[model samples]
Target: MAQTVGDFLVERLYAWGVRKIFGYPGDGINDVFGALNRAGGKIEFIQARHEEMAAFMASAYAKFTGELGVCIATSGPGASHLVTGLYDARLDHMPVLAIAGQQARTALGGHYQQEVDLPSLFKDVAGAFVQQASAPAQVRHLVDRAVRIALGERRVTAIILPNDLQEEPYHEPGRKHGTLHSGIGYSRPKTVPYDADLHRAAEILNSGRKVAMLVGAGSLGATDAVIAVADKLGAGIAKALLGKAAVPDDLPYVTGSIGLLGTEPSYTMMMECDTLLMVGSGFPYSEFLPKEGQARGVQIDLAPDMLSLRYPMEANLVGDAAETLRALLPLIEQKTEKSWRADIEKNVADWWKTLEERAIQPAVPVNPQRVTWELSPRLPDGVILTSDSGSCANWYARDLRIRRGMMASLSGGLASMGAAVPYAIAAKFAHPDRPVIALVGDGAMQMNNMAELITVAKYWRQWPDKRWIVCVFNNEDLNQVTWEQRVMEGDPKFDASQQIPNVPYHRFAELIGLKGIYVDRPQAVGPAWEDALAADRPVVLEVKTDPEVPPLPPHITFQQAMNFSRTLIKGDPREGGVIRETARQVLGAILPGGRGD
Candidate 1:
């Protein structure tokens, strides 16, 4: 059997530890698919319903496994479909490699069918590393470089293979045919801040009486180091959404999540802190960050450019999160006064009480927050939860407490919908024994790839256990955007644009040969979840929820408050309902024992 360029590339991918590839088959890359077929169980080709889902699955695979994820597509439309998912990986700093097939070499500059400029198309998403293999001899080197760069830089990379070159024999100069099996040399080196920069950051931290820490996804590997620093300085810890798992919410001094989907305690602590130590998070939304000159800042990141991108820094320590924190631990001075920590802890406790009161409140349509709260306690150890963007993200961020060993992720940077389903699919594929759940909104679930539930059904028999659950928040509205339009722009609710027709997602799941559970009452939320968990197959628990329940920010501005008043005056029918709900929440928070009537 003669080794073709496609076979050589697949072999290299195998050597690089890629056991599976996510993509759809297309005519343009028939040779590559042929090689995949010949690999003979050495690698699995996961055929997604759409090219976009394939790319998303790859990105999620990288995020969950911390390895280079691979997705293949044929030229033109197939390649174009990969843009959004690749951007999600690029912006979120996940390592992914996209391989696309190009038209034959002879078709170049001839305006052939399905011919598009792939380099220009991928420039924005895979700009970090994009190359086209022009000859059979170039395949191995290009694959090696693309994988190395994707892993080393934590960014998306692309390689294009022309149809003609893919089937060609590899016989470059001194190398004999079929003799290129040597491994590529690539290793990620540890980066650490210099002694002087570490000292400066430590001094900045020790100088403040009230210090705070803002953690991001970058801090995942350095949880202990971050906690140690916070303990030493008596600092309050707040997480960026992607860093939700960086620390457990049970920690008294930890403020769960910051920004719009944040808690009151986190907002108050950020405003009050004298010094802010940002670790591995370039959290945008500067309005939520401490006001300029309000707090001296110190930032630690693997990339130098991200160190001071979000806020001005008194010291920028450019190093890996765990490495930087480990080096800075010995230099930081311990704080004796615990008043600042005590105040933040008190607020956090009160906030939890408020959340509990809201979660249990009964409504005609189930309160969406209750779904997350009920599901939280039932999560098995080390569960992997994926949340879709929109209103569901708000409840997940605020109410669902991520205990140690549990992991959560969303489209933090791209903020895209339709990722939760693919993310759960990839998570389950990565760890079949672990429980995987996707908290998706009704609007998001129907967008593009919800058919992936069928994919789950196809693969269910292969796994030892069925631990995948898709809890769909079936509120018939693009609820988050609707609220934003009303509050930010003072627009009246436009039903034609904002409302989505109700869907029976549970029924759809059953039709696809999976377990289905539907809940419309508050009392059913918990039991529905239990049934889903106990099912012997993949499950979809469709929850009918109150769309009128606003996801108000922890701290609403006077203008936003006035906007709601204006909407109410303009005959926005649901405004009154939300107002009453708001009053109940306020009374619940202030009443003795944090109880509501």
Candidate 2:
């Protein structure tokens, strides 16, 4: 049998260690599908409901596996649909390669059906490397370079294959001038900073009486090192959302999450710390960090561009998080003082108690916080959790206590909606033996997640572990944006845009052959999760939650406090519920009799 360009492409990707490809088919790329059929399942092709979901799965696969994630799509709209997901990978520094079909060579400018300039479309997302193969022989180097570059740089890259060229016989580059050959394989180098830079960072860390450490996605493999360094410096560690699993929440001095959806301990520690050590995080909100020059800063990241980006670090050490921290550990002096650590631990303990009180507060149907709070201790060992971007993420950040073995992530840098389901799917694919769960807001579920539930129905039987579950917060409102309007814009909840139709998410899941459980009462939240975990198949656990319960910031500023009152004064459609929930949840703990802003 003669090898076609598509066959050769598949073989090359297999050589590059790609075992799975997520995509949706189209007429523009029929030849590649033919090749995939002929290859006898060397690479498992996951058919997504949409191209965007496929791209998101690829991005998430890369994040979970620490390997190259690849996705394919047809030309024109199919290829264009990959932009958002690719940008998710690009922004989060995940390695992903997008293979998109293009128009035939002869029909390039004729505007034929589905004829689009794919390289141009993918340029921004896969700007590091985006090339369209002109000849059958050119496909080799295109695949090699795209994979190598994406993996080495931890960035998105793309390769465009013309439909006509894909059907041609594969040929090697000629042994002559103007001809080139590319090889397979890439191994990440040992990136570490200079001894002098390490010492400088250590000096700054040692000099401060109160040190605070901020860890992000880059700190994943350096968990032990982060703990050791924090202990030696007597520093409190705070996790950026992406780094939620970098250090266990059970640690006495660990502040759960930072920024808008942060813990009060994290907010307080940042404000009082005399020095900051940032590790591999690109957390964009600078206001949540130490004010300008209040704290001496030191940052360590593999990419120099990310160094000193969020904060003006006095010592910018360019290196891998694990390696840099290990190198700097010996230079650091251990602090004998236990006062700072004691205070941080006490704050964290008290914050957890406050969270417990808030979770049990009554709501219209169910308190959203209680859902996650109840599920925390009940979570199975080695479970992987994902959450969509919205009010659900607020609970995901503040309510869930991620243990040492559990892995949790969501749309961190992009904060995109509709990613949780696909991310959970990818996580299941990456670790089929592990149980995976997704927490989504009703808005995101309506936007895209419901369709992907059909995707789960399609592939659930093959997974050895059938504990995959989607926990939907059916709040009947775009809860996060509604609160943002009231608190950030000082405007009432505009029902026209903020209100969403009440969706029977559990019924939809049951209709699609998955187990469904609905909980409208707070007391049922825990038992419903237990039932979902014990289901024979995939489950959709839907909880009717209150939308008016504000996703309060750790500590509200005076302006934000004013915005809260202004929105109420201007009149809100849910004014009664809003004021009641706000007073019961926020004012009681954040102001007056409670801690002042």
Candidate 3:
């Protein structure tokens, strides 16, 4: 008796050591899911509330385990839902194989139910998009190729299986392809060492009056090399937000993230530097980089395509970061006595002073940024934090200090709202024993598939002792959008108080069997968080905040200056009263530290 192609595909998944598959089963892919079920304990299918969450969970699994994470979707809408996670995987260079179910081969291009061009939709995001042919051998080959592309290239790959093709009888001997390996063992490329180029970099470092290192995500595997390079050159190191853990942030030589949410010290150093050595970082904000004649930019990257795209580069070295950095360390003479490092350290001190001033001065119904920054340090070490899109994402990126082995993942490019719940579930799933907390906004959470909270509840039921907390900064409005509109259009009508219907977030939390704590006062948040984290299962801490608080990007902005002056002129009138109260509490905390320069 011949087997179905779907059955053969399940066997291949088992052969490749994929023990679990995360997805939703639908009419389009019922045959495959059924085959997955019949395969018994060899492979388990974990159903997700939304296809996107399944993709995100699978993406995180790929990122953490270095294996091919798998997710599935049915035709049309189902496939469309998976695109966001696929984009996230593509941008982060994660390995994932998304098996999307297409309409039957006969109805593929015709006007049939849920029929759409799967290959065309997925072309831009996938490393390889395969449409399985009628032959079982073709199905086998496509699966193998997808798995290889995903695992080998660290990219998202897709394979579409037609309904009839999946159910069709298999005729060929299902020859198993080689299992994918997920280790970083890149073969050394043929190379002639650029002696003069290496020496020029060394000479520049040796001769520079002030040198600053800007690190990026590509330096993840080579952090030690970056640290050594910084130490050798007496250079202060700053990082892109994604590269927070690339170097120890608390190090005296280290400042903060450099971009729109960057610190004064970091921005100052970039402006003051004689030489800016970019190691394995691709900073998207070109404005943060010093214009020519102010500082010279030298970039080192493994990918030739990304070289000098953000800033005009004086030199580009294509090589392994660790090897190249190590080689340069020996050739470069130690800076005997550079005052630039001291100046950077002093600037960092000044920046911290400004942050302290802003934080210590508190008011009633406190600013969300102040509360977030204040509350972050209170969380336990190794606590996993997942942030939602909007201003909260920027706040956490600027304020939180990540320790080693601690995980923080967010939407890189798509910046999707409601990412917090799914991302938190995945983080907790990946690190079951640790405390997982997701910081989300009430408005944004509404957009996410909330039924996934049932999965969170189910996972909590399965493991009752775990601590998975969701902190909702319930401002009762889309405050980030309001602020952005204010910045872009000077629109006073965009204020959150003018629009939005109230949704009781705490009641929603109870619907999912999670404990809910509601804080009307800003001072109540810290203890509420501590209590929530002490609970056995997942808890939601709803913090009521002022929606009109000044937007706190790192730089002291013209918008902020204008807003503050306007507020002062208006005498900071009280409507909601909570808004001013909140600002006052935060301002009180900041008053002792003195003003920002």
**Best lDDT among the predictions, by candidate number:** 2
lDDT of each: 0.87, 0.91, 0.72
Per residue, candidate 2 scores C-alpha lDDT tens digits across 1-597 of 789999999999999999999999887787898999998999999999988999999999998899989899999999999888888899999999999998889999997988887877888899999999999888899989999999999999999888889999999999999878899989999999888888888889989999999999999899999999999999999999999999999999998999999999999999999999999999999999999999999999988899888889999988999998999999999999999999999999999998899889888889899999999998899999999999999999999988888988888899999999999999999999999999999999999989999999999999999999999999899999999998888899999999999878999999999999999999899889999999999999999998888897887776877777788788888989645655546755444344421
lDDT of 1 by residue, 1-597 (tens): 788888888888999989989998888788889999998989999888778888889999998888889999998899999888898999999999999999998998899999999988898799888988887766777788789889999989999988888888865434667444334756779999789989999889999999989999999888999999999999999999999999998899898999999998989998888999999997898888889999999999888778788889999988999988989999999899999999999999999888898888765579898999998888888999999999999998998888899888988999999999988888888888888989999888889647888788788878776879999988888989888876777777888888888878899888989888999989888888888888898899999988777777787775775665566668774666554575346334443344544
Best by TM-score: 2
**Candidate 2, superposed: residue stretches over 4 Å from native:** 588-597
Pick by lDDT: 2 or 3, better one: 2
lDDT of 3: 0.72
Question: What CA RMSD would you report for each candidate?
Answer: 3.1, 1.4, 4.6
lDDT (tens digit, per residue) of candidate 3 on 457-496: 7768755347888777777667677655444444443343
Error of 3 at 50 (Å): 1.4
| TM-score of every prediction relative to native | 0.96, 0.98, 0.87
Pairs clashing in candidate 1? none
